[model samples]
Target: MAARTVSFGIGFRVGGSLSLLALLAACSEPLDLDMRGLMNGGFNTADAARASTAPRPAADNRGVISYPNYQVAVARRGDTLAALAARVGLPADELARYNGVQSGDTLRAGEIIALPRRVSEPSPATGATTTGPIRPSSQIDITTLANDAIERSAPTPAAQRPTPQVGTEPIRHQVERGETAFTISRLYNVSVRSLSEWNSLDSNFSVREGQYLLIPVVTQAPAPREVAPIEPGRGSPTPQPPSASQPLPTETPAAAAATTQAATAAAAAAPPVANVGTQTAASASNAAMAFPVQGSIIREYSKGRNDGIDIAASVGTTVKAAASGQVAAITRNTDGINILVIRHPDNLLTVYTHVDNITVAKGDAVSRGQSIAKVADFEPARVHFEVRKGFDSVDPMTYLR
Candidate 1:
């Protein structure tokens, strides 16, 4: 009876262990929860199946968006002004100017670039139109756009008139040994006319050593003008000729003879005017000519070949007018280099090329040695200067002092 009880106990323990293992195996299986149907309301097999099969939109690589008025471009990594301009079909310089950035500057990744909605407005002076990728107006700062428009539309001041300013005082400078009016004007960064006017001296007056001269400070205030008093209800009457009764005042015979002799001597001492042909032949013979820029000549003019001389100069160097003249043309070349052509007395035209940041415009009257433009970056970094008589080019060295 005891042996039979032990066998039954071992069999019970083994069956219990097998039962526990089977329970654990059942618990390990996935629950297969109906999430979509439960969130909607209860378990609906059809709704859960539809939720799992729906399609979604793919991601975009351009990272750009289109709006009703304007489009925007998101800058990518390693982008430059030139690259952006080329991508958008706009000129690199124009693009830089529009964004108030330099053409050689780099653009930051993820930066917003403002583009024109439609075609850009044509430049009034050049009549050139811009074509490129468009940007929305909302992306650009309104104030910056307005300021740029104002600057482009504002009229340029006359070259002969100095820009006016208030509360300006005269600059006093003491004349040094061997300093002439030209040198003093240059030292003070002033025009010779301003120097003469401030000191009450004539244009031909010579500066003496140890003398103090007052240099006029340029101001925005317009110079005062003298207006004659008008008669009541009409302008001033023209002066009437003296009556015949007042015989023309006559000088003494001895004095008149001496004046006549002096006049004859003065006329004899003056140089004769050259004929048109002679003037053309000797066009490059002005002794008072000034150098446009202080630099060594890299390329000299050769007959039947090069028409101008190239002077080696550092970028951004100030370039002055070789002689006083009226600016006939201020334009850019195909490569966007600035060119200035001035028409001087005696039918002479001086050409300055490869320049940027020009100070004068067309029809401006510039003085000799006046700053006109700054040297621009070119392959060789030089200025091409030409002295021309109508269509004939001459050697600048023959005329430059």
Candidate 2:
């Protein structure tokens, strides 16, 4: 066969046209490619340089789709707070609070709305009322009984009763507008159970204006002694005596030396009271935490599978705070499961998820074993408990005694 050659870009050639693919393969060397440049829409040298130096958006591993800021969500057409909350499995109130909008407020389409990373599951309806915690007879409908009691106890003539002294005896309180039994109980520093028992009223009974009810006189409990707030993983510093700029009195050299020697001896003999107290406090804080809900652990903590331990429990089981701490957040997962996060000392955080009802609000201070919520079924009727040190998840079993 006669030799034939073809010339193409830069030194490319093919001889004798064995096959177009084979000829090209023989002449072409493997070329190094700038994949990044090609992926950036084949940016030119200048554009590539600019892109390399441009600031990149921050990234997180939360596994949720977020906007550039990661804290705000862009509203789409016909997006209401409630609808959006439902779509994201958050409570409407939390979503509204994040956006600084009222729950009933209308939202403009294409508006930029701030969103909380998570939602809070709405507390469950208690008994026949949604106003307060579930009572013993909450499920019982005593409307007829309350009506009968009202009929039986008609208002007494003013002349027949002596006026009560302001602070001496139980006084008659006139029902105000927009007041419920729960609110009345709180105002009087009494319990709803006590109020219902005293007045023979049912949980569902409505209070009307101009109605007189006997307010029970309760002796207020003594206030708790204030303690320094404990931060996570840190101890309270011992207070030192104040120092004066100018020296006041001078003592004899011998007396001063004697005093110094005595102080040193005392300090050396005495145990480290402050450090002991701190360690004791830390130990107590750790010991105070109990399982939020008692159940068999169905799911163990795994790095990628689950962040917390799942305990299988029945619905309406009381969920207590694992430790003494201020409520950091009460949010919900994307599955519409309620989550309660409490910030405790030692940089520790306890999370209770799949809750049925919440009794404490955000920022409320709760003690260990305090009934803060109730557990309900999420996937298999379980409560999810997570112990975290700052942002890192830790095995709860390690710290949980």
Candidate 3:
């Protein structure tokens, strides 16, 4: 029997092979699926680098995001604790201890690290170049957005916002007529470089009238260390008491008795001597400053949280000076709340905030318990009062009567 030879077309075979390959590819897992560090839990450096490139939560201009109770910093790719600390103007060891990490340890990009305390906020002087911090309370209101054309545009990505320095929420300053950046920085006790960086100022630092600027955050400088008081008899040399080197003639029994009786009688008749040290201490106690407001304290002093005490009072209640002093500064916060700073003797300062209807002006001499301002009509109608020694905040209760 003769067999018929069947020829297979080259194109058909090639097409069939291609179809098979396509089917296999469709059924197989995606090439983009990453199963890295799955088998041995040992990730290669290349894999780590790639993973770090993933998007991290956005930080403010200063790479900080502050919550009501705490603040955190978002790490950039290839960041280490030491590098981050230097960038934020914090001690590397301190930052490491706060996050339970070593200063040299590399951090995953976008990892959130807690801060020990606040560092400075976005300052061009410090050379920080990230967008400003995220503060929900500080966000522009809906009404303002509806009215302003610029704010109505699509929200800017966090990376593109003005850079922030590590600190508290920034003060939003509306440019006033004839106001310059230098004057504004002086007003807030910050550097002009900081102001320019925070608001993204022009090369000339020129500000237009009616423009809005973010005032750089400022933290009080650390108080100078105090020298402890010397212990009694330890400060200086004292004359030694009479020694037994010289002996006195012995007295007869009757004479000794008479002399003792006379001494006793004289001692009994003499008036008591007041201790100078005791009197000075008592005077200081009596001189404690009076409370700013007569009301229950709604909030107590908490370092890094509440620097002062909040006293609940009726609106228009007189807020008195905590101590006798000259009004050093009469300013307003970004929230439009009045802040009065008084400079007392011995480097003491008293602060009164959330006030309205200020009756006193800067450089005015005020006596303790004299009215300086009135409590504003805030929701709680409270006055926030603080006592500061130098630049450091101290517990008001320590000085309050």
Candidate 4:
């Protein structure tokens, strides 16, 4: 196909960040993306422009071109900022600021990164319009060129660039309110058919908030990155798992006390986990902690915000605790929402918010990676949660060893 070109102004929005469309401009091609930059210290964006020569907008269109809107993409394990940024013709520097990251960050696997929209403006000098990255007919598609550039200059995709063959079984994901099967599948790299069948969803797609489903991991291993935490956006992104298969009977009042004791002990002895750094106090051991969710972390927890890592789980996927702890608070707040708070022996509190239903209760303790509540198993669900030390929230990825 002929190269697509346009003219438009190129100026940063007064306060907001800008974007340059990278790939799959629209639904003609489905996008699978991840944004584990915050949690995994990775960065990747795809763009379609020559670094030195700026191009004009397509002959037909007129507005200034910038970044694309938040769209979907699948993240294979080891994907980095450079690879991702180049896929859609975006520069690494711009994406870093959007996700609160810098260079040398690896994009986390299994998380869905939402890309922002880019606007194109008309440039005055030539009295011509400025175009965003222009797509030209060439040896490689948008995704390949982006990955190549990153490897040459930044080295983000070197570790994990090759895409993996999708697994046979689509992991079951619980449906949360506000999540559609397509969105969940795109984030996890699973097909919509797989998601629908895994959850036994009907043609009409009837689903509750807390139901269980299966989804296979189509990407590589997961990456848990730690960054300087920022406050999570207050606006609840969208409207919004399962049966007790894993086995914990805290729904009843009788099991509360004993469970709490066991959970507290586990928390006290929280093993050390490794992130980009080690734990604060040598006395505290938090190594050997498993990722609560096997998938990638889409959005990480920020204090005075969700205060917990947001795992991009399918409607029926499992959500476990990062560290062992007792079920401290397990109920909804004034908003009529469901949440679970686990109190570890370390006096750290972990919260699982916006869940469909919880399996544990107050006084009941939990082990690391133990299932406490069903995530958005029914709808396109996100595990909204946090880790707090006594009353202060701390990054769980740091202590999750």
TM-score list, all predictions: 0.30, 0.30, 0.40, 0.29
Instruction: Choose 1 or 3, whichever is better by lDDT.
Output: 3
lDDT of 3 by residue, 58-147 (tens): 355546655445556766778998988887778999888766668999866655566778765533443445433333332222112211
Pick the lDDT winner: 3
Least well predicted 10-residue stretch by lDDT in candidate 3: 47-56
Compared with the true structure, what per-residue lDDT tens digits does model 1 show for residues 306-379? 56778777899998998998887765544466667887888677888888989998778999989999999987
Query: Which regions of candidate 2 are displaced past 4 Å?
Result: 1-288
Report the lDDT tens digits of candidate 2 across residue range 1-401. 22333234223533345465674576332211222332446532221112211111111221122221123333445667777666556688987765556666654443344456732211222111122111122111121122222223334412221111112224456677777665665465555444544444534644555444555445454244489987875775677767787666676689789999999999999886432111111223445467777767777876423657777778888988878898766655444566677878887778777786799987789998899988776557877788877555688767666
For model 1, what is the error of residue 21's alpha carbon versus the real structure, in angstroms, after optimal superposition?
Answer: 89
Task: Give the Cα lDDT of each candidate.
Answer: 0.57, 0.53, 0.62, 0.47
In angstroms, give how far residue 242 of model 3 lies from its true place.
Answer: 99
Worst 10 residues of 1 by lDDT: 51-60
Worst-scoring 10-residue span by lDDT in model 4: 47-56
Per-residue lDDT of 1-401 in model 4, one digit per residue for the tens?
A: 22322222223342223232533354332232332332364332111111111111222122122222212333446777667666545676776555455535775553333334442322333133332222222211212332343234332435544321111222335457766555555456445454544344556444444333345333333333467766677555744255466776647675777899899999889985544222222213546345555544666655432345665566756767767766655555444556666666655566666576567766776787678666665334666656666445578777655
| Best-to-worst lDDT order | 3, 1, 2, 4
Better of 3 and 4 by lDDT: 3
> lDDT of model 3 at residue 236?
80
What local lDDT does model 3 show for residue 240?
A: 86
